[model samples]
Every structure is written in structure tokens, then in C-alpha cells.
Target: MFAPQSDRVALRFGDRSLTHASLAACAGSLARELTGLPRVAVWATPSLETCVAVVAALLAGVPAVPLNPKVGERELAHIVADSAPATVLAAPGVDLPAGLDSVPRRDVTLDGDDPGSFADPGDEAPALIVYTSGTTGSPKGVVLPRRALTSTLDAVAEAWQWTADDVLVHALPLFHVHGLILGVLGPLRRGGTLHHLGKFSTAGVVEALEGDGTMMFGVPTMYHRIAEEVGTTPALAAALGKARLLVSGSAALPVRDHERIATATGQRVVERYGMTETLMNTSVRADGDRRPGAVGVPLPGVEVRLVDDAGSVLDGAGPIGEIQVRGPNLFTEYLNRPDATAEAFAGGWFRTGDVGTRDADGYYRIVGRKATDIIKSGGYKIGAGEIENALLEHPGVREVAVTGEPDDDLGERIVAWVVAAGDAPPSSEELADHVARLLTPHKRPRVVRFVEALPRNDMGKVMKRALRT
Candidate 1:
């Protein structure tokens, strides 16, 4: 796939860069080592070695489990026991935690000639066994096939008007779907260039965009930082002004940051929606309206519908329903969990477990996860997303998370845990009125608690389960 860009730069990290030919040769060399392995675990740090390790496993047609370096020993042990990888691949001389000690290790050394022993695997073959970051229980291994990767990547390219001529830029972790699949493999598949910041920094992003970078992929937190900087940094504003597309995913980008960045750079960050089980189902098209909070329509060949809890597809707006999708983008199954695999699908559509609403124009807006973010107060179903977005607009609010606390009168009351901006904090009444005014009076947070920060996972998603009363 990257043959056309053989001599062109394909991957760049801190103080290191690799051409397409070099990447292919390196992965091919590692493939020779990976061949015939039942499965392999990659110590997936955000580095060139991690990328090369995954690529090498792909080349050798072995299913890989990308292990997050930050994950706890217990979880890591669970993954090791579940996946039962024959070997763990890591960067040279890096000491792996004791959790992975039982598994044999292989250094992902980038050398050796292209042995030409690897062949393209069938689409039915398992490609990756990614673990979910759910709050309820131990992480489940989502088994993804090659076709899911290809279909989603192709669909995104079509939606974004992406081409080999374009250069993609991002500074995200390699362990997740957003960064690894779209950030790394997408560029390789399209024969495009990728510039990794190694770690997200506004200055680094500006420097890349000032160079040959045409597109950027970021999370909400990254865009928030960029928005905070763009107003003061003329170089950043100018660099972003010249970029072709700015995409945000993994979580919802706040509307305030969206408008702030747009006002400064005239670039509306496009948002997309997907999960580990479903690679990608919907995205905002590059040629279409850059709606602030909307994730736009479904991607090509992917069918999405808003269905109420009763299992009937919804028609109009205002009624929040679970997002169900049917497409080739779905994972094959949950590893060794046939019950979960069966429970994930209803008829032909996969229950995404995400609550959302669709307008008459077919634009989709994510509410939140049904298990957590959907709050029932005063016999009304309210999404914490809209309320949180509204609260984020308040000048004194830096970060906010909305949850439903058990109430005697209303069954459940809205609660807001906020990280106040600066030293002076806004009164609970003021913040409540802010949300009430922006949305409806009922959506106002019934109770508010000020905090230093909300607990978050590696991907920057707030862990509501950890918030204290």
C-alpha cells in the first residue's frame, strides 16, 4: 500500500523518522521473527517501536494484543491470561512490568533485510484483540478482523477526501483505536505521511503544520489546549488556518473550544463517533457542514439507527435512544465470551450502548453512555453531555462532569462535579442557573460539588464511577 511513497517520509517521532521503504523493511524483518506465533502482545508505548511491532505482527498475519504501558498489573495479568500470547514484543532494553514476566519476550529490534516471507492474510483472520475500558468489570478483549480495519479506514478516507498527497498529524497514544488504527495504519494504507508529536504540545503541532502537515487528528483535551493557545499564539493560529482538516474523536469536543478555535483560526474541528467494538460508524464529512457537537451522518456502507429501549427505531428528534449500527466495521466477537458476543447484537444491528439523538436532517448528536451519562430526574431522561456542555460555557468553570445522584423526591437528581477556573469558584447556584439558562430549568444541576479534577482514563475520558458524593 505504501509502495508509491517508498522514499517519502512515512512515520516521524521524537528525534527519529522513517521512510515508507524503511518502515516496510523494518516490519518485514520483525515479521520474520513473529511468524507462526499464536498471538503476540505489544508493549504499546507511543513510539516508533510500538508502530513497527504492530505492523510486523500484521505482516506476519498474527493477532496482536496492544498492551497499554500504564495499565495496572492486575489488568495486565488478566489480559495476559485471557489472550495467552506466546510472546510479548517490546522496545530494546525496556524493562517490562512483572505482570508480563510469565510470557516470553522478544525485542522489536528494527533491522534485518526484507525476507519476503509474509503474505497478505484473509479478511476473516483475526487482526487485533483490543481490550475495552469499561468501568463495570474486567476489560473484555474485542476481536477485530482485517475487514473491519479496511472498511472503516476506506470509509473515513472517502468522508474526509483523504489522499496520499495529504500529511496527517497527531499526538495520541498508540494503545487505542483512535491513535493506532487511524493515526498509524491509516497513513500507511493511504500511502500518506504521518507526523507524531510524541507528546501533545501546541508548539509541536504548530511546527508540524507550518511544515508539510495538511491534516490533524486530536482528542477533546488536545483541541481545548490548542484553543487556549491559538488566541495568543499567532503562529499557531496561522498554522491551523492553513490546515486542510482538523478532526477530533475518542470523546466529544466541547462546543466552547470548537467555537474558540474556529473564531481564531476559522477551522471547525470535525468530530466522529465510534467505539472499540465498532471501529467507526459515523463521521462529519469534510465537504458537509462542520457542525459543532454533531458527529454527522453514518459512513458509507454503515447503517445507524436510534432505537428506544423497546427495540423500535425512533423517528423524530428530542427522543434519546441507543445507537444501533449494522456494518462491516464491527468486531468479530469478544474473546472467549460467546454470551457477550450474542448480547451485543439485536437482530442484525449491534447495540452500541451509547445514547444519542438524530435530527430530521440525519445529523447525530451523542448524549452519553446509557449506563452512566443518561440521568433520569423528575421523570425525565436527560443527557449529561448537553448539561455539561452548557456548564463548560461558564467563565468560572474549567471542567465539569454531570451524574445522577439518588434523590428521595425526584427518584434521581442531577449532580455536577466541577473544577473551577482559577482560584475563585462560581457559586453552585450560579453554575446551576448557567446550565438552566442555557438549556432548560430542569436540566440545572440539583447539587454541585467543586473539585480539583475529575478522574480520567488514559484516553482523557472522565471516569464517573470514581467521582465521590
Candidate 2:
């Protein structure tokens, strides 16, 4: 890909840009310097240097572990000790944290070997050691091979009609699969150009779209902000309306936001489903039905199935079950934890804690997470996602999260935590009635709590455990 697009700009961050030839030369120089290292830790920031470091590690066949720039001290210590990288790769003048300061540092710069190509790592070789979020306790390192990375990027490209002519624009972090692999590596694999906004801002998004941006990718939080502004900000709406393709992932985008953006821009943002373990299982195709909440069918080369608690395959109209997937896009293993690795796979399918239902048309709709989003209330299995979507339609509701709380009468009672949109939010009774009218009375929140904001993970997923606590 680089050999042909030597003079073309491959990446852009703020005012800095890297042509394909320069990217190759710069990364190759770093690669040659990191030749003997078994693995390297990249201080993943949304910058040209971070992009160059990742490309260099891949070229050198040394597995790269991306550390979140905003990582907590405990998580940082665990990652540093577990991966045991020979050195840390960082942008020039960027200060290392206490845990990483002791490690040898290599400053990534454009002044490297002359423009040339290097051998790509084998498809089966380890490419990344991305750590899972420490939701349960400490995060675990997920080992991803070159095969998984390429297969996922290729599938997404085919689905989105992505090519060198398409210029991608985003402002997501570079520490995770959504930001790093799909956002950065995706464009590179297709020989396309990437414009990163450094950090997400409505103004930045509008600027990029107003320019040469053809495709946009964002998490739910970013889309939520877009939804808020698009109604009153015609310029922002126009900018988004001009985008060739809009995608939402990492966390589910509320149906209300989808509708709002669609109504304003005449574009339905495509949604995809994936995790740290499975790079990507399904996505609403660029040409497929752009239903508000559908994650669409499984990507090409990926197999998805729904099974009950007893492990029986689900069939027929609407049976909500846990998602089990099998594909080359799956990660190789959790680094240094064979027991955990074995537990993740059953037969050959990887168990995704997510639960969802599949329609006859093959569009899969996410219900909620098995661990937290599934509400066992009054002998009914209600998914928090649908209720959250329904509640989002309420005019007074700005952000909402649904959960199940303990109750004496019912096994669990549904709870709705909301952030009001205006000075006066809708009454709990009125909001509950609204949801009942939209969904069902049984699904309405038995208790509604107003809050300043919903606690969320970096990807914008509502942290249900925090609400429970």
C-alpha cells in the first residue's frame, strides 16, 4: 500500500501530516532501532508520533502494547509489569508517568531512514497486546495476531466501500481497538488518508467534515454531542450531512440519537459490534438497512450465533441469547493466562458477555450485557438497552441509563437514572408513562433518579456497576 502512495498524505493530526513514503521511512528507522526487542509499549496519544510508533512496531514484528495516556496508576503498573516491554515508545517531549519513567525511552521522529519499505510481520505473528478495561479488577492483556488485525480491517473496508479515495476523519483515542486498529490502521490498510482531531470536539468535527473528510467514526458520547448541537447548529448539521459514511461503535448509540442525526443530516449512522477479544463480529453494512439500533449482520468471514444459558442454539422469531462468535478476527489469547483463555472459548465459539436478538433479516439487535444490562425483574428478562433507547426519546431527558435494583415484591425492579436536558426534567411518573407507552408497562422504570450525569467508561458505555454501588 505504501509503495504506490509514496507522495500521498497518509495521516494528519492537527497541523502535522505524514506522506506515505515519509511514514514508511520514519517507522522503518524506529523499527530498525527496536529490532531486537520482543515487545514495546507505545504511549498511545492521538498524534503523528504515536501513529509512526505503532507502524514501526508492526514493521519490526515486535508486538506493541498501547498504554492509555489517561491510564490510572494501578492499571499502568499492572500493564508495565505484565508486558515487561524492553522500552517505551513516545512522542518527543512527552513526559512519561512514574511507572514508565524508569523504562528506557525512544523518541519517535520523522528524521529516520530514507524512504523505503520493510517486510510486514507474518499474518500469524503477534501484532498487539491491548489490555482490557479493568471493570472487574485489573485488566488483562489480549494478544492479537497480524491475521486478526488484517482480516478485521479488510472486512470493514469491504463493508464500507473504503478505498484510497476515501479520507477518514475521527477524534477517538488511540489506546483501544476502535481508535487504534480500526481508526488508524484501517485507513493505512486501504491506502487512504486519516485526519485525527486530537481530541473530540464538535467544532473540530465540523472543521474536518467541512474540509476533505468523507467518512466519520465516533463513539456514542461523540454522537450524543453531535445530536445535541445538530438541532440548533445548521452548519454542524450540514457538515455531517456531507459525510459519505458515518459509523458509531465502542458503545451502543441510543436510538434517539440515531433518529436525531438521521432526521437532521439525512444519514443513518452505521453501527458495529465488537470487543477487545473479538476485533469485530457484526456491523450494519454501508449499503444495508440503517435501522436505528441494529448492529447489522455478521461481517464477512465471521460467524455469529445466539445460544441460551444451557448452550442450545437459538432459532425462530425472537429469542434473546448470549452472542457466541467464531472467526479469524478473534484474538489469539489473553497474555500469560491459559486458564482464562480456555474459559473464554467453548467448542470453537468465543463467548461474548453481550446478549442480543437476531431478526429474520439477519440484523442483530443488542439487548444488553449479560453481567449488568440484563434485568431479571418479576420473572421477566428485560434488556436495559431497549429501555434506555426508549427513555432517550423523552424531550427532557438528556442522558439515561437503565438498571435493575433489588426489590422485595419483584426479584428486581427497573431503575432509570437520567440527566435532565432542561431546567425542569419530566416528572418520574410522566417519564415512566412515556416509556410504558413506547415499550411496555412492565419495561417502564419502577424508580427514576435524576442525576447531574451518568457515569461512563472512556468509550461512553454507562457504568452500571457504579449506579448499583
Candidate 3:
């Protein structure tokens, strides 16, 4: 069995490297002091220290809720109120919420007694509470058991063939599952070294991968930017090609971005399908074909299917419907909302609330969310993802968000929020024309609004509701 890292480098940010033993010691110290509390809230930056805190909580058998350090007072208060954490551990220099006791992560010192107090948790005990996007309503926490994570880490390690010889250049934030489970836990479980980047700059990531780094994890937005940067320069693209696997998730990976990455750097991005609830369920196989739009077959022990509105299982890939998942990694329940938890499951499968179709080979192709983000216009259902993917193909478009704006004639009109890239920024008319040339008439954006940047939540997902506001 794999034990926690002891001698190898656990985290690397900027110029610093923290060894596994040191990271364990740091977490052990925090765990020792917090033995009285059942839960602790981790409000911190995406750093090596935050990674250590997570491990400490897990090994110490105290569930840790990693809060997005960027949220405002009201949002923080909501999370603190909902989770009811006994203590909040804030990164150094971050302000703490009212009525919450604070501990500066740096000030947490580890000694002999700290490590000695550690206890293994029951496999069925709740380990984490990652909240949903709350796009449709108030965000509810999804409770994951220790066994859920332990199983997920095992599946990912086996599927990816992770090893100490591998190096993961991770750019995603630790607050989310993609960064935490796929980036940190799975890698550490295999004794693989992690080169964690505090902030992503195309140059910085390129520099890190130039070393022994073998893999990378990023959100669609980050990969889009990296692809764009590489498109502008050839040598940089060549350097990026050195990494073996470039994985993306948290949102749909645009086919254009995938093609650009491969064309520029000769590295095919292995886009995976996963969420905060179930960790990683599907991935583009490293040794097999990297299909453009397909998030490859379900991982070991995961059962994926598409069902009609009536909750009846559908036949071979035809019409898209709700995607349901059943696996050992599935969340036990939504933290406090019993109704929502019950409603989320139909029969034995967890209703993903995501619309997708599975191909003959069982690879899943996500169409859009079942909720409001999906746009219906002129008797045709349009996916915001489809239009957004089209907008990303435009050379002058840096970032884009698509939303369904209510229309008088059409049920909903597609409006795009774009971050302009070039000297002659593409006007809404020009972008509309550009999209018109590539997509069906219905898929084109009716209006395009240029913006400094799209609003994103702590998990790096573009807050579509915020864009509409």
C-alpha cells in the first residue's frame, strides 16, 4: 500500500520546494491542535501551504472544507454559516470572517506530539463538503465520504499510471476537486512529485514543464490562453509539447482550443469530465485516441448512462438527455438539504443535471446543462457551450461567455460577452459575421459585448449568472 510522501518534494511554488515529510509535519501540527473540532474551514490562496493543510486534515481524520479565499464577506459568512466549522484557518494576510476563530497557516508549527495524535478516519465518514455553483439556486454542500475520495484517488492513479518518475505541473486552484483530487491527492498517492504553480503565466508554466514535469492540469480558460499564447509564438509551442498529458476540466473544453494546442505544441489535450461531487469520472485515455469532443469512457467502477425525462434508460446514442452517474465515488448526500439530495437521484443513478449523449463506445459527449444556462430559441435548443466554443475560435477573442437573453420574437437570443484580443477588436457585428461563417444561423451570437474579463468563481468556472447581471 502507498503511504504519504516522506522524502520526495511535496510542493513547488515559484522558487521554493517543500518536502513531503515537512508537509506532513506541518499538517500534523495543525491537526493536533484541532482534535477537538469535527471540521475546519480552509480559507487560503492556491499555495503549497494550502495543500499541506488538506493532507493534515485528512490524516488527522478532521474533515476540511477549502473555501475560496476570494469571496466577499457575505459569501464567506454564508459558507461559514452553512458548514458550521468550529475553526477557520486563513492564509497569512487574509482577513477572517466575523465570529470565526482564525489561525494563520504559517504560524501552524509541527512538533513530535502533533504527528503522534493523528488518527485514521472511518471509510464511510464525511471527508469534504464542496459546494455547487448555485447557478439555479442557493449553493448546497455536497458531502463526500473518506471512502469516496480514497476510491477516486485509486482509480485515477491506476488509470493514469502515475509514478514518482512523473511530475505534474498544476495551475488549477486547490479549492476545487480538479486541483485537489486529480492534481494533489492522486499524484501524492502514487508518490509522484507535484510542481504547483501559484499563478499561471504562459512563460512560468513553460519554464516548469521544461524540467522533469510530465503532466499538467488546467481549466478550459487557462488552456485557451496557453493555446493562444502558443499560436502567437512557435518556439514556445514547441517547449509546451514536452509535457505528455495536458488535462482540462471544470468546464467544457472547446474543440478549437484542443486543436490549437496540438497544432501549436504537438500535445493533444486530454479533456476529462468530472465535477466537485464525484471527483473524476471520465478522461481522454493517454495511450489511446484523443477524441476532440468525447470525454472518454467511464473510469474503472463508474457507470455512466443517459436517460429520458421519464427516468427510463435510453437506447444507443441518439437524443441527448440527462446524464446520470453511479459509482463508489458519488457523494453521499448534499450536506443539509434532504429534498435536494433526494431529488438529485432517480432510482440508483445520481442525476447529473447535465445533458449529454453517449456514443457506441460509451464515450460521453456533453451538450449543456439542464438548467437555465441552456438557451431555447425559435423551437431549437441552443447550447451556450456551442456558441462559446465558436467564439473562442475567433483570433481576436481572448475569453468569451454565452448567455440566453430573452427576446420578443425569438424565445431567447444568444448574447456573447467577449474579452477582445487584437489591435482592431472585433465588433459585435464582425464577431456575429465571423460566427455566422462557421456555425449554423441559429448558433451565431445575436449580440457580442466586449469586456475586460468575464466574472469567475473561486473554482475558475465562469459565473454565467454574473455575466447576465
- Pick the winner on TM-score between candidates 2 and 3: 2
Question: Which residue pairs of candidate 3 clash?
Answer: none
Candidate 2 per-residue lDDT, tens place, 1-469, comes to 2336467889999898998878988888888888768999999978999999999898888999998776655557888989999999999999888889768998889888654456766788999999873224346799999999989998998898999888899987898888899999998888889999988889999999999999999877678788888989998999999999999886667778898899999989999999889999999999888999889999999999999999999986589999999999999999988988898899999998889999988899988767776665543446677788778888999999888876543446899999999998899999988877655466789999999988989999778899889
Cα displacement (angstroms), candidate 2, residue 208, comes to 0.8
Cα lDDT computed for each candidate against the true fold = 0.85, 0.85, 0.73
Query: Scored by Cα lDDT, where does model 3 land?
Result: 0.73
The residue-by-residue lDDT of candidate 3 on 28-127, one tens digit each, is 7776776767788776567766776677777767778888655434345556778888766655566554435433233333332344445566888888
Write out the backbone clash pairs for model 2: none
lDDT for each residue of candidate 1 in 1-469, tens digit (9 for 90 to 100): 2334378888988678888888888888989888899999999988889988998898899999998776655567778999999999999988898888899998887675683656778887899999874433456899999999999999999999998888999987787788899999999989888899988888899899999999999877678788888999999999999999999886677788889899999888988998888988999999999989999999999999989888998988778999999999999999988998899899978998889999778999998776886665543446677678778889999999988876543446799999999889999999888876555576789999998889999999999899943
